[model samples]
Target: MESMKNRESKTAGSLIDDPVILRLFERMPHSVQESFTEEQLMHLKVAVGSRGWGEHAVDVRGSFRGWRHRYYYVMLFGRNRRHLTPGQKRIHNLISAAMLTGFVCVGLLIGLLGLYLLKSAAGIDLFPDHSLGIWDWFNSN
Candidate 1:
């Protein structure tokens, strides 16, 4: 009987060691927790499983009071680690492509503008008869 009790205690100990089960146990009132049987604890462990909420690179939480009201906020930022559906994957790809295109276009525009300014400063013009008025505006400013 003593050995059987030891075995039961060991099983319960192992279940309680699981982080998810331990968290759940911690949340339960002490009186309620003391009343739980090993079998019930095992059931809780099985039901909760071992998965955890994903970690975040940045996690911020705060509370503030304004106008006699209290408000809370959470901000989490991280690389996505979840599985994506095919349509969702396609949308992600499209967004990524569009961002890349926009970035490249902006970079090229800045490079061309810099080159044009340099050429104007050096008194070099490909078309002497026409003006974009940028150099004149730059000089006036």
Candidate 2:
């Protein structure tokens, strides 16, 4: 039998390679088994170069693709995210894709919302009114 440390390392490696796993961590607490071990999360934070939760930092050597895949897989399944019916993998994928896409969309929406809220709250426009479009500048005073 593989040593426990070896097993854990391999298991952790596998988990870090899937996107679904990554999402699970983002959405909720990990399973009971995962409650204590933060290796996967740590790996991700290392890969992302930040804490891996708030703002994303630059990729460390860009090898984080591996880290991201593993993170995603674990989060997608965790303890209960494996082996559906014949087509369930497809559904799972759609769900995973939707999760990521939703994150992007929500991020964009929040960014826009923040901009709007900031502008409205501060009553400050990014662009000045006195500044004319290039063409308008040529055409008028």
The alpha-carbon deviation from the true structure for residue 15 of candidate 2, after best TM-score superposition, in angstroms, is 39
Stretches > 4 Å off in candidate 1: 1-54, 60-75
Per-residue lDDT of candidate 2, residues 2-26 (tens digit): 3334435875565544564466456
Best by TM-score: 1
Model 1: number of backbone collisions: 0
Cα lDDT of candidate 1 equals 0.78
TM-score of each: 0.52, 0.29
What lDDT would each prediction earn against the true structure?
A: 0.78, 0.54
After aligning candidate 1 to the native by TM-score, how far in Å is the CA of 140 from where it should be?
A: 2.9
| lDDT score for residue 117 of model 2 | 59
lDDT of 1 by residue, 1-141 (tens): 223234346745555466766688677786666666666767887777644444678889899998999999999898887899999999999999999999999999999999999999999989979989999998999
Model 2 misplacement above 4 A: 1-78, 84-86, 126-141
